[model samples]
Target: MAADITVIIPARNAAATIGAALASLVPDRSLIREILVIDDGSSDRTVAVAVECAQRHGLPMEAVSVRLDSAGAARNVGIERASGASIFFLDADDQVMPGSLSLLRAALERQSGAGLAIGASIRRTKDRPDKLKTPDGYSPDKRQNTRRYLRNELWPIAMGSALVAKWAAAHIRFPEAIHLDEDTCYWTALLARADAVTIEAPVLVYHHDEERMARRFITAPRGTFLAIARELDRLATAGVERDALQWRKAWIAQRIARQLIKHRMFADAAGMMRAVRAHKELGGSPKALQYRARIHIGRLTGIGAGASPTTHPAMPQRTLIICHDPPFPPTSGADLRNFGNAVAAAAFGPVCLASVAPWNGDAQPVDHDIHVTALTTDSQRQAASLGWRRIKGEARIPRPALTRLKTLVRDFRPDTIVVEGVALFKLLGPSRPLVRQLILDMHNVESDLADQLPRKSIWRPRFSGVRDLERRAAAICDRIWVCSTSDRERLRTLLSKPVPIDVVPNGIPRAEGIPTVLPQPAVSDGFPVILLVGHLGYEPNIDAAERLARTILPRIRARLPAAKLVLAGRSPKPPVRALAGLDGVGLVDSPDDVRPLLASAHLCVIPLAMGGGTRIKILEAMAWGIPVIASPLAVEGLDLTADEEVLLADSDEGLADMAVGLCSDRARMMRLRARAHDVVWGRFGPRAIRDAVRRGLGRNDAGS
Candidate 1:
């Protein structure tokens, strides 16, 4: 018999992999009508490789290149040109099993008038076992089958795993708008109209990569979720039994709701729960009943699942702020930024801080106006932060806090949510957020910082997930805030979509009763104190402190034996404390104030090997009118200039030399102190933060 199946492979920059995909189809050449390799504007040798491989294998292949930029769009073009009665969709990077396509073709041909044939496929993921994925055989009941496809992962309606009739392909095209999961939507829609038969024959060798946009579950915007829901809604109205369609929609809502609830994103979850409840078919569902009971108990307990929270006159707009550390009496650099940003948000309207506080919990009495919800105890937080729970790139929350958070969201529906950093992002859940405005504050372009860190072989894969975390957070957020233009530029490429990125430089509050000109340190007459200030528990600080004590301090002592090095900050780790045991290094552990250390220290040396963001400790030193010598990376985003406001050095020997040089030169010390203070007071102070917050909130307000 002449070939009757047209295989379509939509490729984009797949030069290295497309040949294997083409070669896999050679055995079924007698059954294939033609092969169309649609190259979607490849800047590589995708077309050339496809053509070369096709000729070598003696397979009928046509190479077509166009600037579609979307795989769905490229597939649609291939569909338009296909001549076969049955259409097989293949990805450029994946391979088809030799006999599976033959089995699939026979299944459709055997089942009289069947429009689709489904086969098993094995998904190959990195460092994981190959698992067989086969669809549950189709039944006469369309609604039941549809529901099963939506609910069960094993019953997948995957593109390469299923072969559909040419008519069905023409009737239902792939959604071109979304960057990911276009195939899922396309298959679901086609499966709705076509009666499919299944065989447990493996067809596709799907290679899965977590970084692939199509496989990523967490980072999509609200528009992407809406697009999926809207299509399902349309399918519900379009002859595929409404019950089946509605059930899938409701199930999707519940899935999203569970994620939202898990993260204590209550308002968003409430909205999703309402959608789930709308599926009248799900009225008696255990999940549905559970959602109903929560809302019922919430209302009785005065936490009403009210409509969107804006009817109250007191709050024109509500905001929710998230932070993993304490937000009161800001001690560390992170603490100061989180607290400052929260205070700024509180000024415009009501603000609620969701503190994922430490195991011991926050000690400060947060008695002020803004409501604080302590979500976890030390045990719960530790349990939630475990490696197993975070493999999927989302932070887990305990069951006990879900309702409390839902109650808060139901009662206090925030119009905007300010996620402090990527540290707590996983706790925000896995799908599109329901809040009107979502803002991400980047203290460090954390993914960039992570890339710079030296990792042990065993820890490499786990730490690599940080990029996914940050990228996914960026994908969901409406806008992003960075500390510097350099950070803004580096971070833009990491986002799944282009969001408005604003550079909100880090700043410190102007201290009271401080003289504009600081007096020269008593270094010439006494021991010279060279300080390195930071949250000593932090990895970068720990490394820098250890290096200074073990290496740099000894070099400095060789020139000037009286010079002493002090590591000052909150929460000094064991390694940092060990620095004090060294000859000239002193450890200031968990100081209530660093002002005394700054006041006495003649020169601050930050000889960091790897760090991120503008060093806030450097700013604190400058604000106290102290001279600083830091690595170039430490001085990033700050207005301080090397050889003028601050001294910059990349090497430990050079840092020690600068410290020794400054000890005797009181005139140079005076000049650096005065200049550095002016830079901080004039460029980096409380006013900078206030202005940035107002601008950020104001833009959202205008848009709303």
Candidate 2:
């Protein structure tokens, strides 16, 4: 017997695509007991199109016109009129796949405890092929644990791809107050009491109109944020763990703040944060505290309503250093440069470091008299999706980071603003009067780095967009600082107008003392260790680690049976973490200090395939008098002689051979290490870096 299923499609101004949506359902008419279209105050002929399609198909369908402000209200009305045992929500602009209704109903009938059956949806655009966007933590074979499911899957399960039992539908109502994320709130409430079954098949085709959706979000009124906060509060009150819901709440608030910041709606953004703070569920977490700090800072800095920027007449000169990430721990080359340069800039004036820190990172204390201010928000996570917009030279800033930056700029009122990396150059807008001089520190020619990446990488296409950003930065900045002469020349070619380009090569900190732990050969039974050190969370590092473990390490072990690989770094990603369990490989995460690992190593290996900046790891190894073997790309832009200072290899065989030979030849290893140490100290040392930074900042007196 066919199970009863009702299709409820709530639409507003969906006249253009209603016919195709209805036509796709004709084949499964027997399974669909009723097709109801609730039109919510459409100015177009949407109701007419819906009714015409229903009549032409000769289906048991009806169209109802209602006056409602939101689609959730329309959905609620449809639920009241639905007579089928199972309810399937569809969108008027989308189409259901053939036989999807029957497939969904059969799954429901098979499981007595399951109240909802979800199928995957494929997003389609006019130019691109269909892509499957499955719900987070969705598994076809495993039954979902409700609490775990809700906690893992923060994104909305496509409403058009779900079939809910009438019993479950009776208990849950659509949240009409929220204009955004309403579907997420409604589905979470419905799924709380019901077990869910996921079908691993595409049951619906969702039309992705990026331009229209972006416009809708941009134009949404401030009430939308309030409605979302209220819905989250309701969910928390219904016994869902507030901790499980906190990240989602923070994510929503941060998104709203970003949009507000984009339009320079500082006052509105502050008010929104105040309202968000009032929510019981969202108020007390670390994220909430950060938001409160941002609000307070905004009010104090005259970024909020009726506030004025305070002038510091007594201060002679102030410098603001803006970076994408906090320059502490100095794990990567970029971090070292940023930290070192900021410290150097402090010599000329009082330096304030305004940086973006991770959402979960603990607050770091200030050192070297450089005032530290961190913007902790989850906006960086959203960069993978909408980040391309910024690369395209769009005048946009991620709000969570931007708000703190604006407040700092106004409060600090720096005479000189040193913007680190091209990634954050967009923060320097045309309207700011507080900034007397702007200097752009180019970490690398980012667009050129993009071109060097593999063709399949997501960043490859986006790399072209960065060229425009660099060109704009060059046009506006008073001075441009490149890490190497090669990068400076590249930027000159990329820019239409010549900008003053200064070369400030990356430098190594002066050695305090050599490690007391002498480099020792392993016991007779133990293996000779080869150490690779980096921030394992970085993509290039991850790629290098994987290749070393999977491809290069095996070949090395084959030649020298007792060869061991040690990957020492902080915050290893899942893939990098998995390499730890491999035979003869050690994964050391977030080492208190890397010196111990470097001290015990037989040799330091840098097998990077693609990168733009010079490897600070190589320099560090050389400084420690540890012989280094690195890829040519890893040593790019450095003045080191390949054979004398470093053994360069681009292949697994060459790297393996170099390791085997160097580990056996003690005198040769010591000689190469001595030469490498001389290269680092002579050229890429403290004196060279101090002089370069002083020149770049146009300062004559840099303290020795």
What TM-score do all the candidates reach, one by one? 0.51, 0.51
Writing each residue's lDDT as its tens digit, candidate 2 over 19-55 gives 8889989988888889888876565899788788888
What is the RMSD, in Å, between candidate 2 and the native fold over all Cα?
Answer: 26.6
lDDT of 1 by residue, 39-129 (tens): 7756579999988998999999998765444688788888888999989999988998887778898898898867888888898898799
The per-model lDDT (C-alpha) reads: 0.69, 0.70
Q: What is the C-alpha RMSD of each candidate to the true structure, in Å?
A: 22.8, 26.6
Alpha-carbon shift of residue 113 in model 1 (angstroms): 99
Off by over 4 Å in 2: 1-317, 357-367, 375-389, 393-396, 400-403, 430-432, 509-527, 702-704
What clash pairs does model 1 have? Answer: 359-378
